[model samples]
Target chain A: MTRVRVDLNISLDGFATTADQTPDNPFGQDWGRLTTAYVGTRTFRERVLHDTSGAGTTGVDDEYAQRYFEAVGAEIMGAGMFGLHEHGDDPEWKGWWEDEPPFRVPVFILTHTPRPSIEMKGGTVFHFVEASPEEALARAVAVADGGDVRIGGGPSTVREFLRAGLVDDLHVAITPILLGQGIRLWDDLRGLEAGYDVTTEAAPSGITHITFRRESRG
Target chain B: MTRVRVDLNISLDGFATTADQTPDNPFGQDWGRLTTAYVGTRTFRERVLHDTSGAGTTGVDDEYAQRYFEAVGAEIMGAGMFGLHEHGDDPEWKGWWEDEPPFRVPVFILTHTPRPSIEMKGGTVFHFVEASPEEALARAVAVADGGDVRIGGGPSTVREFLRAGLVDDLHVAITPILLGQGIRLWDDLRGLEAGYDVTTEAAPSGITHITFRRESRG
Candidate 1:
């Protein structure tokens, strides 16, 4: 079965990113710190940063980070995550990721104003579409070709998919920092645990990795 | 060097207790499930329930629950915790605890309508007082006799102390269940980790124990 998964790095207070995000400051001041655990992982350095220096922490955090890219295919992301609001009608904004984006699959960007698909150097293909979470997921799933569909988020997007009951597995790495104000991942996500079996593992890097896997509906 | 500490069992969404809290449903529908991790501990059975059966889990959860009563002399709680709203105008009404309450120290209840102190069985004494978090901490510290002063909460009370930057150490046990809606412990207390050295430990019972030890001000 193709699983729908989401992997996000959040603060201890449940904030995934700060509020004052802009084109230049995509994640605000706390972004680096919030994702310090993942960014310092060997998997992140190799897969995301394309760095094979063999640097970065290798343990519980790395294990979890490595799992982030283990399975299947397509990704569904929010407009804010695509850096659209910042470059506003630039007609040239590819994305925050470098020419060779990390995601080596068909990426669906959910936005109000759809744009032409942008295929980067790598296997990543950004296909902008204005559709509901279910529709987007369906499209992503078809593109995934039986592989898992990843719900990439900036908080609001993830919350929508979760509320729609489309997410199958969710992994949240809670860093020890506290971002006073930002987009909260848990807002409107009441009784979220009722549908999933939740488990937590505390890593040596002071990050608590929480995974929620969907139980059988029956 | 007396420390001010807080120990609370919160849901995955940060709710310490549910919203529809009543005298009959003191902790709301999910109370039992949320606190099962703590209540099932041998320390809770012995100390709170006064059970000497010695029949309870004795692992990480038990170890942390056992520390709930260590090195704390006085306790400060809210009126809701004292059950004043339930049995209003009934002077005979004491707390919901048994004739012998679990707290074996001077217990201060912060309420707008202060009443005469009530001495319960065992070493627990309920003293009603109307004061700010700092003032209440001062009174509790005085009675603590150089011991630690514990901030016993129903969420709002703990938020106040945390906002005042008076807590020396805070321990929050994140239960697997989600209350959906209730009194949130992290509301308005943003940037809370700035003052504390935070750490986390995931227990076998699926509870994540998060601790914040205040960093030296100087």
Candidate 2:
């Protein structure tokens, strides 16, 4: 079985983004520490950002970044993270990460509408799949081979997997910012009975890098 | 006019609660720096938990907490925050809060099912209203008099308010933790064209307390 992993940045008060989310402030400054964590390490930054210069040398954050990037094979995300036309009828904008996206592998997006697969300059290919989480994971896992399957999300997509007990590994870079009013990641899931073992926990800079493995399912 | 506010604790990666979200890890962690924020200052701690000591101190967190307890004449929350149900149909669980909840005001819970209002010890009355956000906010605001209406949510409730532009002010206390694979607050709200101004930012602790005022719709 292919291990499924999740990695994302979060604020201290547990907000992924502000309530009135706009292009200007996406994750809000609450996730500043995570952003700092990303930029702080030269090797991790270079690998993810396509500017490969440093490697092997170890730092606190660099280890986390390396582990996260290495564990995942392909990425699966929700369309909301890709664009924004969630409520209203008008569908105009794409995503904040325009043109050249960050991911090097093929990225699958979960949505109701259908859009053409956009292939960016790098190995980033955005495939809009209107299937369920199982199908998406199947495709991602197949592509990942022996590597891990990663769920890239704003929150709902993650919950979809967690509710089904499909996730295996988890990595969260917790920043120390709070958006007193915005979207929250944990509101929809309240009664879930999943147990996670904290395999790794390190406070690099200010953000804590914690990794968890899902325990036995009843 | 009466002011309304929301004071929530979140992890650095923006998870208000952990992924597994059980009664044991209610707020998560035995006592990390984040959990300590809830009972942090001796004076404020006494007032909230014991209802004494923290009468008139005004640190950033104190000011923030005061904003919630003082200005918030009434509040609106979700079923997830209210309680943990065994079955979606089960009616035993009321909420994770103790006999006397933290908020000593009128709290209107937005639920799909109908239930009678449960008035607690302090001045807290939980009115389970099976209405829309607009309806809930209207009722809450009506009860608020001049006080601002605080949207105490898990995430969906806040998103509804943001989509409706009914919220006036938002204060987020971004913590430094993350449940990367749970529900996300900003999942379906990626493309809304809303704007806000960062009015105040104070880092009393490592948790930078920030306030974002939504742009006027006029």
Candidate 3:
């Protein structure tokens, strides 16, 4: 039974993304501020950035950061996260990530422009498809191969899966900052704590980690 | 010198109020769930509700609840929170509170229709005025007399004070619930965490209390 999980770093105002995006700095200034705790984690420094200097935070943030990469057979993300819109529909765009991407599993990209599966170094394989949230999850779960199917986000993509009741565990790191604008993560998720056992833990670095796990996980 | 402070209970999605308001139950259904950790505090039970049973929580929620009433020489609230919209200007509505209101301070109500001061049984005094956030804060600070002037809110009023840079301390209890709709407290207040030293503490009851105190106090 592969559980569907989500992890996002949002502002106190519930904004998952910042409004200060420019061509020079695509992720925006506040994006760095919003993810200060996560990026400072040893796991993030080693895994995502491929910087194995062993120089990063190793507390609560790193604990969740470790859980982020642990036991996720497959991943799903939006076109924006995959930078398909930024790079255009060119076949040469292998994604914003490095040659050896982070997720070493079947990574499903939700997009309108269908593309051939791009197999990168390591285990990450990007599969582009135009499908509904259910269809996307089915493909991801099928390829998950018994590990948890993680819902990698750009906010809206994660919202779609959450609204469809496909998420088993939702862990949101609420960083103590106000982005005031941009995409909000909790816009349409009213009464989302209905069936999930919600728990929260505040890290010393001023980020609160709130987890909502399904009471009856299959 | 009187410092301007604010205390609010908001959902994880940043909604300060819910949309389930009806004639019978004015506060809406999710309001209770949103403020469960708050109203369950010992200080809230005693100070707000006047429940002398001494039967309430005495944890992190209670600690903050106690701080909510400490040294509050005066308060400024919106007409909505004052129930002016619900109850017409018959001059008979003594603010929907009991004869002895919880706020034993000069309560400034921002309204279009000004009314003479109404002195309640306790030290609570309702003074209706048609002034901007600055003007209202000025009046409240004038009466504060060395104690802190609290910006009591219905979301918008607090945002006004926050935007005007009149707040010295802002403590928001982010309850782990999503209303999905209603008044957002963090709108238009971009980069609100700028100069303030932000901190967070997650309670066992699943409420994360985030505080932002101004680094430089006048």
Candidate 4:
């Protein structure tokens, strides 16, 4: 069975995005610290951003990031992350990653409406699915063959999977940023049962990398 | 006038609580880091939990946490933070704060139905209000006098404030834990206009502390 993983950054006060998420500020104050910590090092940045020259080095955070990427064979994302085109009336919107995206595998996007598949350079293929998380995961698993499926999130899609109990191993890069009010990953769940054990932890470049494996409950 | 500040911690992948929230694992893997970094420090534990000290003096995270508490005169939270309890035939629920919550100020809970105020020792009063976020803030500000009003969250309340654009400063301590499935701080606002500037960045105890100040579009 393919292990499902959903990952993202969170603040101490508990907010994912800042109040107003305009393009000028992608991640408010947290992105820089998170990026530097996760991608700042020579080797890590070069690897993820697809650069020839590696600038970052071997640290705990870098190691965790590397582990996360290495474990991912396929990815599932919410439309919120695919692009900000959801807000505008135009249908010509693509994503923030002009032409080529970061993921180098088959990526499935969860949306209410369906669209044709978008093929980017590299092996990145964007497929829009209007089905629920489980349905998408099922299709993704078929496409994944014998690899782990990573959930690229905008929060809601991840929550759907979590609510449905579909994720396996998870890693979250904790970035120090507070949005005072944009979209928060934790909203209406006060009475739910969830448990996890820390599999790994690292602190580097002012970012903390922690991994958790969901505990199966009878 | 005391400005209102929202403070929190988040994962890089963006989850506030685990997919299923329970007391045993109130916040999934993030809670452990928070306990050790925010509440487990010798100085902080003695002060916030045992009342044997004032506050932690050193470390970036300690300093940031101290500053956040100092800035708040009162806290306004949501029902999600209160956890589950059987109130009436409708499953009446109270908060999970137990007898004496760490907060030593007036705490207002935003809810649709009003309840009698429950006063705790050390000045923490749980007042259930059926007012809007603006109304709750008004009461909080008045109670705070000249102290900053802190919008303690569950997500809905935070979104209320964020949508209103009433928050001034945000202090976030990002934790390195991923629930993979849980409530997120930012699930809505698919097409909202928001912006901010990171004024401070620091890493201590493996957690990053980042501050974002709301910016105007003009």
Candidate 5:
């Protein structure tokens, strides 16, 4: 069974994304500021930025950033993450990523209006699905083969999976910045820590990485 | 120049106290569970519990717990923290603490109905005052005698001081327990991190200690 995992960058006030997000400023004023710790990592530079210059920090933040891409086969993300909401009806909007997206596996994009699957270069394929979290997870799990299914998020998508108790492990990098108003990750998910064994590690980049792994009932 | 400091034990969801708080259950259902890290520390056991046996954990948690009383002279707390709400209209109500409270200086209780000052044993004195955060801080600072003024909290009072930006340093211990509903300490205080330099340290006891020190502007 492929375990479901989620990794999110959240503010100290629990906001995963800012309220001022728009087409022009998708992540709002604090987007770049909040993700600086991750984006400055060597793994993120190579994987996400597709930079071959061999730049970026290599420490605790990089260690956690490297783990984010490890042991994950397929991914399930919301429409917002795919930039479908912002660039409505724009066929040109493949995704925020370049020609070769980082997943290197089948990626399921959950949207209300489903579109035909788009297979990109470098072993990355986008499958648009209009299904519930359970259905979506099954589809992603099937595509995942033997590896884990990662729940790529914009906060709401992760909240849905978490509320359904589908997530087996969660990694939250709490940035020191405060977005104040945005979509909260912890709303309505009270007593969430009871089912999980939690551990926290503070990185030198001023970000606190909190990991929660589900405890086996047996 | 007496710096105002605050120390609170909060849940992962940012709750300091639960809704079911009462005289019988001071900290509600999660009191003992949430405060286990602090109460189990050698500093807390010695200062607050008045135990001189030198028992309890001696590590990161204890180091942070010890700072709760270091370099501080006076304390300012809400009426709810003093148990005035539960035991109302009783002049005989001295306080929940015994004769020698942990605080060895003047402690101001912010209440609507002010009462006569009661000087306790062991250099501790309780004074009831109907004052705002600034007014109360002024009084506490004066009595602090150049030491810091500690904002002892029940959440709402701390919220007021935080909103006013009177706190110079804040230490919050994020416990592993999750209390779903309660008075949140981070509510209405958005963009609070912008004014301070924040750092996080995780302890072996599974509690993450977050510190925020106000940045000095020359």
Candidate 6:
């Protein structure tokens, strides 16, 4: 079964992105503070940063971090998340992730200006497409080959997928901080827990991870 | 030392109160759902509901629920919380808590129309005063007599106290539910975590308890 999944780091006040971003510092200080728990995870170090050394936390947070990467055959993200809005018309710019991007699958970037697919190292291919969430999901699912489709986000993109009820599994790592400014994740998602079996676990690093898995509709 | 404390049940989307309130059902159904974890606790069962059967959850939720009713000499709350606005000038309305009120201390009601103090059976005296958050805190602190003053909330009252930097301890039980409508708890309190030492714990009942204690400014 190909499940649609989402994982994000949000503040206790429900902000997923930081407002303290600048031209120089694209992801502000609050972003670091919010994602501290995820970044400190062993799986995050190994997967995202490609840190080969067996360092970093291998606790509950790492367990969730490990789960985030597993079973995700394809990813869909917004143009802003791909830094296309920032690096406009720069054909050489291939996103913040260097040669070895973490996602080792076909990543569909939702944008009007669909660029040629750039195949990075480690089996990661960046495919730009001008498609709605449903269309993107279909593309992702077609290529997923029975693996799960992950709605890899920068908040807004994830929210659209959530609003459409396309998500089957959702996880949010809530850092114990309040960034009063940023893109909020739960703006119009009232009564979102009706169809999902929700669960919460606190990490020692002060991150409360809440998971919502959609039960089979009987 | 007389510390200023606050405890509230908020949704993951930051709503402290529910929107599904009618004249007949003042609290509404969402209120019951939001407080299910708290009301199911042993301490809440004994203290608030006065259940002597010793039947309820005695887990992390109970521990916090037990602490909520402790070390409080006085409570400061809003007029709405006291149901003053709902039952205007009706002498019989002693509050939602029928006869045996929860707080066994002087409860200061922040209102424009100061009425005669109502003394309930269980040492719970309701004093109405038209004062600001600081002024109410001063009155509460004076009567507290070396005991901590708890800002018993309706959300707005607690936010006022928090904005004034008068709160020493703030604990919020983030119920894993998205309430699309109602009063938001976190607003304009940007960089609110600067002085507080934050911690989080997840309860078995799917509640994420986040505690923020004011660290020494020095």
Q: What is the TM-score of each candidate against the true structure?
A: 0.95, 0.48, 0.97, 0.53, 0.94, 0.96
Worst 10 residues of 4 chain B by lDDT: B84-93
> For each predicted model, how many residue pairs clash, with residues at least 3 apart or on different chains?
0, 44, 0, 57, 0, 0
Instruction: Report interface Cα RMSD per prediction.
Output: 1.5, 9.6, 0.7, 8.3, 1.4, 0.8
Q: Model 2: residues >4 Å from true position, as ranges?
A: A1-218, B2-5, B20-27, B30-33, B42-44, B51-58, B84-94, B191-193, B199-204, B215-218
What is the C-alpha lDDT profile of model 1 across B42-130, one tens digit per residue? 99999888889888889999989878889889999999888887864798888889799999899999999888998989888999999
User: If chain B of candidate 2 is superposed on the true chain B, what is its TM-score?
Assistant: 0.79
Model 5, B5-55: lDDT tens per residue? 999998877788876667788557777778898999999999988889999
Query: What is the CA-based DockQ of model 3?
Result: 0.92
Tell me the RMSD of model 4 versus the true structure: 9.4
- Please write out the lDDT profile of model 4 over residues A68-180, one tens digit for every residue: 66756689988777864464244666667767676778899877776778788877788878888878888888888678899888777776777677877656565544344
Q: Give every candidate's TM-score on chain A.
A: 0.94, 0.79, 0.97, 0.83, 0.94, 0.96
Query: Tens digits of per-residue lDDT for model 6 on A24-131?
Result: 987878888988889998999999888899999999999999999999899999998899988958998899999999999999999999879999999999999999
Model 6 spans > 4 angstroms off: A216-218, B215-218
- What's the lDDT for residue B15 in model 5? 82
lDDT of 2: 0.63
Best by DockQ: 3
User: In candidate 5, which residue ranges exceed 4 Å CA deviation?
Assistant: A22-26, A215-218, B20-26, B215-218
For this target, which candidate reaches the highest TM-score against the unseen true structure? 3
User: Which 10 consecutive residues of model 3 chain B have the lowest summed lDDT?
Assistant: B88-97
lDDT of 6 by residue, B109-207 (tens): 998988899999889999999998989989998999888899998899899989999999999998988999999999878778888988888888899
lDDT of 5 at A188: 87
List each candidate's DockQ score. Answer: 0.70, 0.05, 0.92, 0.07, 0.69, 0.87
Name the runs in model 1 displaced over 4 angstroms.
A20-26, A215-218, B20-26, B215-218
How well is each residue in A126-198 modelled by candidate 5, as lDDT tens digits?
Answer: 9999999999999988878788899999799999999998999999998876676788888888788877889
Q: Candidate 3: where are CA atoms >4 Å away?
A: B215-217
Ranking by DockQ: 3, 6, 1, 5, 4, 2
Best by lDDT: 6
